[model samples]
Target: MTFAATVLTLYPEMFPGPLGVSLAGRALSEGAWSLDTVQIRDFATDRHRTVDDTPAGGGAGMVLKPDILAAAIDHAREKQPAAPVLAMTPRGAPITQARIRELAAGPGVTLLCGRFEGFDERIFAGREVEEVSLADIVLSGGEPAALAILDACIRLLPGVMGAASSGIEESFEEGLLEYPHYTRPPEWEGRTIPEVLRSGDHAKIAAWRKQRSEDDTRLRRPDLWERRGGARAQSASGARHEDRDQGQ
Candidate 1:
Protein backbone atom coordinates (compact mmCIF):
# COMPACT_ATOMS: atom_id res chain seq x y z
CA MET A 1 0.00 0.00 0.00
CA THR A 2 1.21 3.51 -0.78
CA PHE A 3 1.72 5.62 2.33
CA ALA A 4 0.17 9.06 2.19
CA ALA A 5 1.45 12.04 4.21
CA THR A 6 -0.58 15.22 4.34
CA VAL A 7 0.91 18.32 5.91
CA LEU A 8 -1.21 21.34 6.84
CA THR A 9 0.92 24.41 7.34
CA LEU A 10 1.15 28.15 6.77
CA TYR A 11 4.23 27.73 4.57
CA PRO A 12 3.28 25.12 2.04
CA GLU A 13 6.42 25.81 0.00
CA MET A 14 8.62 24.37 2.71
CA PHE A 15 7.26 20.89 2.28
CA PRO A 16 8.88 18.09 0.27
CA GLY A 17 11.93 20.29 0.96
CA PRO A 18 14.32 17.74 2.36
CA LEU A 19 11.74 15.08 1.67
CA GLY A 20 12.25 15.89 -2.01
CA VAL A 21 15.79 14.54 -2.14
CA SER A 22 17.51 11.24 -1.41
CA LEU A 23 15.57 8.12 -0.41
CA ALA A 24 12.37 9.87 0.56
CA GLY A 25 12.41 11.92 -2.62
CA ARG A 26 13.09 8.90 -4.81
CA ALA A 27 10.33 6.92 -3.14
CA LEU A 28 7.99 9.89 -3.51
CA SER A 29 8.66 9.99 -7.24
CA GLU A 30 8.19 6.24 -7.50
CA GLY A 31 4.90 6.40 -5.52
CA ALA A 32 6.03 4.27 -2.61
CA TRP A 33 4.49 7.18 -0.70
CA SER A 34 2.72 10.46 -1.46
CA LEU A 35 2.97 14.02 -0.12
CA ASP A 36 0.05 16.41 0.01
CA THR A 37 0.13 19.91 1.47
CA VAL A 38 -2.68 22.15 2.69
CA GLN A 39 -2.10 25.83 3.17
CA ILE A 40 -3.78 26.98 6.44
CA ARG A 41 -4.37 30.42 5.04
CA ASP A 42 -6.60 28.93 2.37
CA PHE A 43 -9.10 28.12 5.11
CA ALA A 44 -9.29 31.66 6.41
CA THR A 45 -12.47 33.48 5.38
CA ASP A 46 -11.21 37.08 5.62
CA ARG A 47 -9.46 39.33 3.09
CA HIS A 48 -6.10 39.15 4.86
CA ARG A 49 -6.40 35.41 5.44
CA THR A 50 -5.61 35.92 9.09
CA VAL A 51 -5.23 32.57 10.80
CA ASP A 52 -3.77 33.81 14.07
CA ASP A 53 -4.68 36.37 16.69
CA THR A 54 -3.34 37.85 19.93
CA PRO A 55 -2.94 35.31 22.74
CA ALA A 56 -6.07 34.95 24.89
CA GLY A 57 -4.43 35.82 28.21
CA GLY A 58 -2.04 38.44 26.75
CA GLY A 59 1.20 36.72 25.78
CA ALA A 60 4.13 37.73 23.55
CA GLY A 61 2.89 36.05 20.35
CA MET A 62 -0.33 35.23 18.58
CA VAL A 63 -2.17 31.96 18.93
CA LEU A 64 -3.53 30.10 15.95
CA LYS A 65 -7.24 30.91 15.81
CA PRO A 66 -9.32 27.93 16.76
CA ASP A 67 -12.02 28.41 14.15
CA ILE A 68 -9.58 28.78 11.26
CA LEU A 69 -7.62 25.69 12.30
CA ALA A 70 -10.86 23.87 12.96
CA ALA A 71 -11.93 24.51 9.39
CA ALA A 72 -8.61 23.20 8.15
CA ILE A 73 -9.02 20.10 10.29
CA ASP A 74 -12.48 19.47 8.89
CA HIS A 75 -11.22 19.93 5.36
CA ALA A 76 -8.30 17.55 5.90
CA ARG A 77 -10.55 14.93 7.44
CA GLU A 78 -13.02 15.18 4.59
CA LYS A 79 -10.20 14.18 2.28
CA GLN A 80 -8.70 11.50 4.55
CA PRO A 81 -10.99 10.59 7.40
CA ALA A 82 -9.03 7.81 9.08
CA ALA A 83 -5.59 9.34 9.18
CA PRO A 84 -4.61 10.75 12.55
CA VAL A 85 -3.99 14.50 12.71
CA LEU A 86 -0.73 15.54 14.38
CA ALA A 87 0.03 19.05 15.64
CA MET A 88 3.75 19.85 15.73
CA THR A 89 4.54 21.91 18.82
CA PRO A 90 7.26 22.03 21.44
CA ARG A 91 4.70 21.26 24.11
CA GLY A 92 4.01 17.94 22.42
CA ALA A 93 5.36 14.55 23.40
CA PRO A 94 8.70 13.63 21.92
CA ILE A 95 8.69 11.73 18.62
CA THR A 96 9.96 8.19 18.83
CA GLN A 97 11.07 5.51 16.37
CA ALA A 98 8.28 3.23 17.60
CA ARG A 99 5.71 5.91 16.81
CA ILE A 100 7.26 6.54 13.42
CA ARG A 101 7.14 2.80 12.67
CA GLU A 102 3.49 2.72 13.62
CA LEU A 103 2.71 5.55 11.23
CA ALA A 104 4.82 3.95 8.49
CA ALA A 105 2.92 0.71 9.01
CA GLY A 106 -0.42 2.44 8.69
CA PRO A 107 -2.23 4.47 6.04
CA GLY A 108 -0.25 7.69 6.84
CA VAL A 109 -0.50 10.84 8.93
CA THR A 110 -1.96 14.33 8.70
CA LEU A 111 0.60 16.74 10.19
CA LEU A 112 -0.63 20.15 11.40
CA CYS A 113 2.25 22.61 11.61
CA GLY A 114 1.82 25.29 14.25
CA ARG A 115 3.41 28.71 14.18
CA PHE A 116 3.57 31.91 16.25
CA GLU A 117 2.68 30.93 19.81
CA GLY A 118 0.75 27.73 19.10
CA PHE A 119 -2.76 26.46 18.65
CA ASP A 120 -5.56 27.74 20.84
CA GLU A 121 -6.10 25.08 23.52
CA ARG A 122 -9.72 24.75 22.42
CA ILE A 123 -8.54 23.36 19.09
CA PHE A 124 -7.19 20.28 20.82
CA ALA A 125 -10.42 19.74 22.79
CA GLY A 126 -12.44 20.19 19.59
CA ARG A 127 -10.28 17.99 17.34
CA GLU A 128 -8.68 14.61 17.74
CA VAL A 129 -5.22 15.99 17.20
CA GLU A 130 -2.06 14.38 18.48
CA GLU A 131 0.65 16.88 19.34
CA VAL A 132 4.25 15.79 18.68
CA SER A 133 7.64 17.39 19.05
CA LEU A 134 10.62 16.61 16.81
CA ALA A 135 13.05 17.43 19.58
CA ASP A 136 13.46 19.43 22.76
CA ILE A 137 14.91 22.44 20.97
CA VAL A 138 12.56 24.95 19.36
CA LEU A 139 12.48 25.91 15.69
CA SER A 140 11.08 28.87 13.83
CA GLY A 141 8.09 26.79 12.88
CA GLY A 142 6.77 23.28 12.60
CA GLU A 143 7.50 22.85 8.88
CA PRO A 144 11.01 21.65 9.66
CA ALA A 145 9.64 19.16 12.17
CA ALA A 146 7.03 18.00 9.69
CA LEU A 147 9.66 17.57 7.03
CA ALA A 148 11.83 15.54 9.39
CA ILE A 149 8.84 13.38 10.34
CA LEU A 150 7.87 12.78 6.73
CA ASP A 151 11.41 11.89 5.84
CA ALA A 152 11.62 9.39 8.68
CA CYS A 153 8.32 7.82 7.68
CA ILE A 154 9.08 7.78 3.96
CA ARG A 155 12.40 5.98 4.29
CA LEU A 156 10.69 3.11 6.11
CA LEU A 157 8.12 2.54 3.41
CA PRO A 158 8.42 -0.80 1.64
CA GLY A 159 10.92 -0.88 -1.21
CA VAL A 160 12.17 2.64 -0.40
CA MET A 161 15.28 1.05 1.12
CA GLY A 162 17.36 -1.55 -0.69
CA ALA A 163 17.53 -3.94 2.20
CA ALA A 164 14.33 -5.10 3.90
CA SER A 165 16.15 -5.86 7.14
CA SER A 166 17.83 -2.46 7.11
CA GLY A 167 14.88 -0.88 8.92
CA ILE A 168 14.97 -3.45 11.68
CA GLU A 169 18.67 -3.03 12.45
CA GLU A 170 18.63 0.72 12.89
CA SER A 171 18.91 2.55 16.22
CA PHE A 172 15.92 2.43 18.62
CA GLU A 173 14.49 -0.74 17.06
CA GLU A 174 16.01 -2.74 19.89
CA GLY A 175 16.26 0.22 22.27
CA LEU A 176 19.99 0.40 21.52
CA LEU A 177 22.05 2.86 19.53
CA GLU A 178 23.22 1.60 16.13
CA TYR A 179 26.64 0.01 15.99
CA PRO A 180 29.50 1.78 14.23
CA HIS A 181 29.82 1.32 10.46
CA TYR A 182 32.83 1.19 8.13
CA THR A 183 33.16 1.28 4.38
CA ARG A 184 35.19 2.01 1.21
CA PRO A 185 38.96 2.48 1.54
CA PRO A 186 38.86 -0.13 4.37
CA GLU A 187 41.70 1.89 5.87
CA TRP A 188 41.39 5.63 6.17
CA GLU A 189 43.69 8.14 7.86
CA GLY A 190 45.39 5.33 9.78
CA ARG A 191 42.07 3.90 11.03
CA THR A 192 40.93 0.51 9.70
CA ILE A 193 37.52 -1.06 9.26
CA PRO A 194 36.98 -3.21 12.31
CA GLU A 195 38.88 -6.39 11.47
CA VAL A 196 35.91 -8.61 12.33
CA LEU A 197 33.75 -6.97 9.66
CA ARG A 198 36.49 -7.73 7.14
CA SER A 199 37.07 -11.27 8.39
CA GLY A 200 34.30 -12.52 6.05
CA ASP A 201 32.78 -14.48 8.93
CA HIS A 202 29.07 -13.54 9.19
CA ALA A 203 28.75 -14.98 12.69
CA LYS A 204 31.64 -12.95 14.07
CA ILE A 205 30.39 -9.84 12.35
CA ALA A 206 26.93 -10.27 13.88
CA ALA A 207 28.40 -10.82 17.34
CA TRP A 208 30.65 -7.83 16.94
CA ARG A 209 27.71 -5.65 15.89
CA LYS A 210 25.60 -6.74 18.86
CA GLN A 211 28.41 -5.99 21.25
CA ARG A 212 29.05 -2.66 19.64
CA SER A 213 25.41 -1.75 19.92
CA GLU A 214 25.36 -2.68 23.60
CA ASP A 215 28.60 -0.91 24.35
CA ASP A 216 27.75 2.19 22.36
CA THR A 217 24.32 2.55 23.94
CA ARG A 218 25.70 2.10 27.42
CA LEU A 219 28.37 4.68 26.79
CA ARG A 220 26.29 7.31 25.03
CA ARG A 221 22.58 7.04 25.81
CA PRO A 222 22.50 5.44 29.18
CA ASP A 223 18.90 6.56 29.29
CA LEU A 224 17.91 4.33 26.37
CA TRP A 225 20.11 1.55 27.67
CA GLU A 226 18.41 1.48 31.04
CA ARG A 227 14.94 2.19 29.71
CA ARG A 228 15.17 -0.97 27.64
CA GLY A 229 15.98 -2.89 30.87
CA GLY A 230 19.50 -3.15 29.55
CA ALA A 231 21.21 -4.98 32.35
CA ARG A 232 18.23 -7.11 33.26
CA ALA A 233 17.49 -8.09 29.69
CA GLN A 234 21.12 -8.86 29.03
CA SER A 235 21.28 -10.93 32.17
CA ALA A 236 18.10 -12.80 31.30
CA SER A 237 19.63 -13.99 28.06
CA GLY A 238 23.00 -14.47 29.70
CA ALA A 239 26.11 -13.00 28.10
CA ARG A 240 26.99 -14.45 24.71
CA HIS A 241 30.33 -16.01 25.60
CA GLU A 242 31.03 -16.05 21.89
CA ASP A 243 30.68 -12.26 21.92
CA ARG A 244 33.92 -12.02 23.95
CA ASP A 245 36.26 -9.36 22.59
CA GLN A 246 38.81 -10.82 20.22
CA GLY A 247 41.43 -8.91 18.30
CA GLN A 248 41.22 -11.92 16.02
Candidate 2:
Protein backbone atom coordinates (compact mmCIF):
# COMPACT_ATOMS: atom_id res chain seq x y z
CA MET A 1 0.00 0.00 0.00
CA THR A 2 1.24 3.48 -0.82
CA PHE A 3 1.78 5.60 2.26
CA ALA A 4 -0.09 8.86 1.64
CA ALA A 5 0.88 11.99 3.59
CA THR A 6 -1.28 15.12 3.71
CA VAL A 7 0.22 18.21 5.29
CA LEU A 8 -1.96 21.11 6.52
CA THR A 9 0.19 24.19 6.62
CA LEU A 10 0.10 27.92 5.84
CA TYR A 11 3.14 27.51 3.58
CA PRO A 12 2.35 24.83 1.06
CA GLU A 13 5.32 25.60 -1.17
CA MET A 14 7.86 24.69 1.48
CA PHE A 15 6.96 21.05 1.12
CA PRO A 16 8.29 18.33 -0.95
CA GLY A 17 11.24 20.59 -0.17
CA PRO A 18 13.90 18.19 1.04
CA LEU A 19 11.36 15.43 0.66
CA GLY A 20 11.61 15.89 -3.09
CA VAL A 21 15.26 14.82 -2.99
CA SER A 22 17.31 11.77 -2.00
CA LEU A 23 15.71 8.44 -1.04
CA ALA A 24 12.38 10.09 -0.24
CA GLY A 25 12.18 11.71 -3.65
CA ARG A 26 12.96 8.41 -5.34
CA ALA A 27 10.23 6.68 -3.33
CA LEU A 28 7.74 9.40 -4.21
CA SER A 29 8.55 9.07 -7.87
CA GLU A 30 8.19 5.32 -7.72
CA GLY A 31 4.68 5.60 -6.19
CA ALA A 32 5.80 3.96 -2.96
CA TRP A 33 4.21 6.97 -1.21
CA SER A 34 2.44 10.25 -1.97
CA LEU A 35 2.37 13.84 -0.77
CA ASP A 36 -0.60 16.19 -0.53
CA THR A 37 -0.47 19.75 0.78
CA VAL A 38 -3.45 21.65 2.17
CA GLN A 39 -3.38 25.39 2.66
CA ILE A 40 -4.95 26.11 6.04
CA ARG A 41 -5.73 29.65 4.93
CA ASP A 42 -7.85 28.25 2.12
CA PHE A 43 -10.42 27.30 4.73
CA ALA A 44 -10.70 30.81 6.18
CA THR A 45 -14.11 32.49 6.06
CA ASP A 46 -12.92 36.11 5.90
CA ARG A 47 -11.76 38.09 2.86
CA HIS A 48 -8.29 38.48 4.31
CA ARG A 49 -8.15 34.67 4.67
CA THR A 50 -7.08 35.07 8.28
CA VAL A 51 -6.22 31.81 10.02
CA ASP A 52 -4.83 33.11 13.31
CA ASP A 53 -6.07 35.43 16.02
CA THR A 54 -4.93 36.94 19.31
CA PRO A 55 -4.58 34.36 22.04
CA ALA A 56 -7.52 34.13 24.44
CA GLY A 57 -7.26 35.86 27.85
CA GLY A 58 -4.05 37.65 26.72
CA GLY A 59 -0.82 36.30 25.29
CA ALA A 60 2.21 37.72 23.49
CA GLY A 61 1.50 35.94 20.20
CA MET A 62 -1.51 34.97 18.10
CA VAL A 63 -2.93 31.45 18.11
CA LEU A 64 -4.01 29.55 15.02
CA LYS A 65 -7.77 29.76 14.78
CA PRO A 66 -9.45 26.50 15.68
CA ASP A 67 -12.33 26.86 13.21
CA ILE A 68 -10.08 27.34 10.19
CA LEU A 69 -7.75 24.51 11.13
CA ALA A 70 -10.69 22.27 11.90
CA ALA A 71 -12.12 22.94 8.46
CA ALA A 72 -8.79 22.10 6.79
CA ILE A 73 -8.42 18.90 8.82
CA ASP A 74 -11.94 17.81 7.99
CA HIS A 75 -11.32 18.44 4.32
CA ALA A 76 -8.12 16.38 4.36
CA ARG A 77 -9.78 13.58 6.29
CA GLU A 78 -12.58 13.28 3.77
CA LYS A 79 -10.01 12.03 1.25
CA GLN A 80 -7.84 10.02 3.66
CA PRO A 81 -10.32 8.59 6.13
CA ALA A 82 -7.93 6.00 7.56
CA ALA A 83 -5.04 8.37 8.20
CA PRO A 84 -4.43 9.72 11.67
CA VAL A 85 -4.37 13.52 12.01
CA LEU A 86 -1.24 14.64 13.90
CA ALA A 87 -0.52 18.19 15.02
CA MET A 88 3.12 19.18 15.38
CA THR A 89 3.87 21.35 18.41
CA PRO A 90 6.46 21.74 21.12
CA ARG A 91 3.88 20.97 23.81
CA GLY A 92 3.13 17.56 22.30
CA ALA A 93 4.58 14.18 23.14
CA PRO A 94 8.04 13.63 21.68
CA ILE A 95 7.81 11.61 18.47
CA THR A 96 9.56 8.23 18.50
CA GLN A 97 11.01 6.01 15.81
CA ALA A 98 8.38 3.45 16.75
CA ARG A 99 5.63 5.95 15.95
CA ILE A 100 7.27 6.76 12.62
CA ARG A 101 7.39 3.05 11.78
CA GLU A 102 3.74 2.69 12.73
CA LEU A 103 2.73 5.57 10.49
CA ALA A 104 4.80 4.21 7.61
CA ALA A 105 3.10 0.84 7.91
CA GLY A 106 -0.34 2.41 7.79
CA PRO A 107 -2.32 3.69 4.83
CA GLY A 108 -1.18 7.32 5.35
CA VAL A 109 -0.93 10.26 7.77
CA THR A 110 -2.28 13.83 8.03
CA LEU A 111 0.13 16.33 9.56
CA LEU A 112 -1.10 19.66 10.99
CA CYS A 113 1.55 22.37 10.86
CA GLY A 114 1.13 24.97 13.58
CA ARG A 115 2.05 28.64 13.11
CA PHE A 116 1.96 31.98 14.92
CA GLU A 117 1.91 31.20 18.65
CA GLY A 118 0.65 27.67 17.91
CA PHE A 119 -2.70 26.00 17.44
CA ASP A 120 -5.49 27.12 19.75
CA GLU A 121 -5.93 24.50 22.52
CA ARG A 122 -9.51 23.78 21.51
CA ILE A 123 -8.53 22.56 18.04
CA PHE A 124 -6.82 19.53 19.54
CA ALA A 125 -9.71 18.57 21.81
CA GLY A 126 -12.49 19.43 19.39
CA ARG A 127 -10.81 17.76 16.44
CA GLU A 128 -9.37 14.85 18.45
CA VAL A 129 -5.96 15.47 16.89
CA GLU A 130 -2.89 13.65 18.14
CA GLU A 131 -0.01 15.96 19.05
CA VAL A 132 3.58 15.01 18.16
CA SER A 133 6.84 16.82 18.86
CA LEU A 134 10.08 16.47 16.91
CA ALA A 135 12.17 17.32 19.97
CA ASP A 136 12.34 19.56 23.00
CA ILE A 137 13.53 22.46 20.84
CA VAL A 138 10.97 24.70 19.11
CA LEU A 139 11.13 25.85 15.47
CA SER A 140 9.98 28.98 13.66
CA GLY A 141 7.19 26.93 12.14
CA GLY A 142 6.06 23.33 11.71
CA GLU A 143 6.82 23.02 7.99
CA PRO A 144 10.39 21.90 8.60
CA ALA A 145 9.35 19.36 11.17
CA ALA A 146 6.54 18.08 8.96
CA LEU A 147 8.99 17.67 6.08
CA ALA A 148 11.38 15.75 8.30
CA ILE A 149 8.63 13.46 9.56
CA LEU A 150 7.33 12.68 6.09
CA ASP A 151 10.85 11.95 4.88
CA ALA A 152 11.36 9.49 7.71
CA CYS A 153 8.12 7.69 6.94
CA ILE A 154 8.73 7.59 3.22
CA ARG A 155 12.13 5.94 3.62
CA LEU A 156 10.56 3.08 5.58
CA LEU A 157 8.11 2.26 2.85
CA PRO A 158 8.78 -1.11 1.21
CA GLY A 159 11.41 -1.02 -1.57
CA VAL A 160 12.31 2.62 -0.85
CA MET A 161 15.68 1.67 0.62
CA GLY A 162 18.19 -0.29 -1.45
CA ALA A 163 18.70 -2.93 1.19
CA ALA A 164 15.98 -4.06 3.60
CA SER A 165 18.61 -4.49 6.32
CA SER A 166 19.67 -0.87 5.88
CA GLY A 167 16.58 0.27 7.77
CA ILE A 168 16.65 -2.59 10.29
CA GLU A 169 20.30 -2.20 11.27
CA GLU A 170 20.30 1.58 11.76
CA SER A 171 20.01 3.57 14.99
CA PHE A 172 16.89 3.18 17.22
CA GLU A 173 15.65 0.06 15.41
CA GLU A 174 16.67 -2.12 18.35
CA GLY A 175 16.39 0.42 21.17
CA LEU A 176 20.13 1.16 20.91
CA LEU A 177 22.13 3.40 18.63
CA GLU A 178 23.83 1.59 15.77
CA TYR A 179 27.50 0.66 15.84
CA PRO A 180 30.06 2.89 14.16
CA HIS A 181 30.87 2.21 10.51
CA TYR A 182 34.19 2.38 8.65
CA THR A 183 35.18 1.96 5.01
CA ARG A 184 38.52 1.78 3.19
CA PRO A 185 41.34 3.50 2.90
CA PRO A 186 41.48 1.24 6.00
CA GLU A 187 43.67 3.89 7.64
CA TRP A 188 42.69 7.54 7.82
CA GLU A 189 44.98 10.11 9.45
CA GLY A 190 46.72 7.24 11.33
CA ARG A 191 43.37 5.96 12.70
CA THR A 192 43.07 2.37 11.54
CA ILE A 193 39.79 0.52 11.16
CA PRO A 194 39.19 -1.80 14.09
CA GLU A 195 41.17 -5.01 13.43
CA VAL A 196 38.23 -7.26 14.33
CA LEU A 197 36.26 -5.76 11.44
CA ARG A 198 39.00 -6.80 9.00
CA SER A 199 39.46 -10.29 10.50
CA GLY A 200 36.81 -11.71 8.10
CA ASP A 201 35.12 -13.69 10.89
CA HIS A 202 31.48 -12.69 10.95
CA ALA A 203 30.92 -13.90 14.53
CA LYS A 204 33.74 -11.76 15.96
CA ILE A 205 32.68 -8.80 13.82
CA ALA A 206 29.10 -9.06 15.05
CA ALA A 207 30.20 -9.26 18.68
CA TRP A 208 32.41 -6.18 18.30
CA ARG A 209 29.58 -4.25 16.71
CA LYS A 210 27.18 -5.18 19.50
CA GLN A 211 29.70 -4.21 22.19
CA ARG A 212 30.31 -0.82 20.56
CA SER A 213 26.59 -0.23 20.25
CA GLU A 214 26.15 -0.82 23.99
CA ASP A 215 29.16 1.23 25.01
CA ASP A 216 28.26 4.18 22.80
CA THR A 217 24.64 4.15 23.96
CA ARG A 218 25.76 3.99 27.60
CA LEU A 219 28.03 6.99 27.19
CA ARG A 220 26.27 9.19 24.65
CA ARG A 221 22.59 8.54 25.32
CA PRO A 222 22.19 7.35 28.87
CA ASP A 223 18.51 8.19 28.69
CA LEU A 224 17.94 5.63 25.93
CA TRP A 225 20.13 3.16 27.77
CA GLU A 226 18.12 3.64 30.96
CA ARG A 227 14.89 3.28 29.02
CA ARG A 228 16.14 -0.10 27.78
CA GLY A 229 17.06 -1.07 31.37
CA GLY A 230 20.66 -1.34 30.16
CA ALA A 231 22.00 -0.39 33.59
CA ARG A 232 20.05 -2.67 35.89
CA ALA A 233 19.46 -5.33 33.29
CA GLN A 234 23.12 -5.96 32.38
CA SER A 235 24.51 -8.95 34.25
CA ALA A 236 27.36 -8.62 36.75
CA SER A 237 29.51 -10.92 34.58
CA GLY A 238 28.69 -8.81 31.53
CA ALA A 239 29.96 -5.68 33.25
CA ARG A 240 33.23 -7.44 34.15
CA HIS A 241 33.60 -8.57 30.55
CA GLU A 242 32.97 -5.05 29.31
CA ASP A 243 35.61 -3.72 31.70
CA ARG A 244 38.12 -6.25 30.40
CA ASP A 245 37.23 -5.42 26.77
CA GLN A 246 37.62 -1.68 27.38
CA GLY A 247 40.93 -2.13 29.19
CA GLN A 248 42.24 -3.89 26.05
What's the lDDT for all of these models? 0.90, 0.91
lDDT agreement of model 2 with the native = 0.91
Clashing pairs for model 1 are none
What TM-score number comes out for model 2?
A: 0.92
Model 1 alpha-carbon drift over 4 Å, by segment: 230-248
Instruction: Estimate, for each residue in 1-248, the C-alpha lDDT of model 1 and write its tens digit.
Output: 88988899999999788888889888988989888999999989999999999986786988899999999999999988989999999999999999999998999899999999888999999999999999898998999999888888888888889999999999999889999888899889998888899899999999999999999998999899888885677775555543554422
TM-score of each: 0.90, 0.92
- Whole-model lDDT, model 1: 0.90
